[model samples]
Target: MEDENDCISSDEEDQLDFLLGEEFGEDDDAELYSPPNVDTLSSQDTCSSQSSQSISDPLERHIYWKDDNTEDNGNVDLRTTPFKPTRQPGFQTTNFTRRQLQHLKTPLHFLNLFMTVEFLTTLCIATNHQANYLINTGKYSSYTDNGVWEAVTTDELLRFFGIIIYMSVVKLSALEKYWSTNVLYDHCPVNDVMTKKRFQAILCFIQVTSPGDIDKGQDCLEFK
Candidate 1:
């Protein structure tokens, strides 16, 4: 009777395993990174939305492996390789440069960066203002008692958004490619790809314009 019961228990365990597998197939692997607050991130990182749209485009994706199409050890074939984007003649110019073409990244990259800075500054100012408002309004007022949870919610949202940005930067560094906010990023090591003099001028301009003082210039944007 014990032997028979052992067989029945084993059968039931197998059935449960099969049911779990069917329910979760690949989702178990995908859910490893449970975003603490994905909705909060969406509302906070507006700049990421523009960048994510470009990343979602199937046409823009590339295999990016050194041995993408060629067979290895006579075992694998083209079908076995990861998805590779067909290289166009123009694509080389885009990645590299020619007489007229310069850096692979478009001018829009700088604009997107500037806008992101503005967004962050705005967030900081709003948060500080909200804190002062709450503290000064009444005695011993707390966020929960005030019927508003904006401070905690917004704080967590920004923190995760920062993580997303850092992870993207790390991944792009690993890939040695950058794609964000309708802009591109690449560098051509080869000389004479574009005018050296023109490149020097751009480098000089960037160096000359960097802000040197922050605290000193706090009153520059005075609210009058």
Candidate 2:
């Protein structure tokens, strides 16, 4: 009886050990098969790496032609390809009004003549400064010398010629009327004395034409 009891106790101990072993196996399987949150971190890292790589390469941001298979590599014909500039668009073309165009033609003609004369004279004067100085001074002299002001006379002569030509060529209609008016006969605002004399004459005409006048000139003014 003592030996049989001891055998039964040993069997119970073996079954307990087998059950513990099975429980530990199940725990290890759960740990291995059930993944942790580290996979989320790895996915985020992969996306960040792709974004950084794209940022490092400028060509990745620019537009590129693709083939039917979505391949980016292609031949670029720079001559035939039109490129849009990265700038603001400007005004569209427009035509001038007829009246404005006609008025502009006269000013443009005068401006062209002025510019041509000014450009040519300036070029000649700049290139021949030394010659001009000698001719004006009547001798060889340094430009910075005491009496070198004589060289400036040559420039004055050139300016005088330009002014005379401009005045002779350019004219307005008002100048003719101004010359035709006689200050002695007409009352002039600029000629204050003549204006006063004309005013006195008008007063005399008024006095002579008064109601009680018995004069011939008074009668003539009355008729007037």
Residues 1-224 of candidate 2 have per-residue lDDT tens digits of 22542322333333334435544664433211111222222243454445334433332222233345764355554542458876657722245456644565564454554456555455344434544444365653333245442222333334433433543665435433222356543532223322323222222222212232335554454644
Off by over 4 Å in 1: 1-115, 139-160, 163-224
**Poorest 10 consecutive residues by lDDT, candidate 2:** 30-39
Clash pairs (backbone) in predicted model 2: none
lDDT of 1: 0.38
Where in model 2 is the C-alpha error above 4 Å? Answer: 1-114, 121-137, 140-146, 149-162, 166-224
Where's the lowest-lDDT run of ten residues in candidate 1? 201-210
Count the clashes in each prediction: 0, 0
lDDT of 1 by residue, 1-224 (tens): 22542322333333334435534654443321222333332342345445334433321231122334655474543542456667754334454337445432675443344446556555545544544454456522443334432332333334434434544655645322322223343332212232333222222222111133235756756986
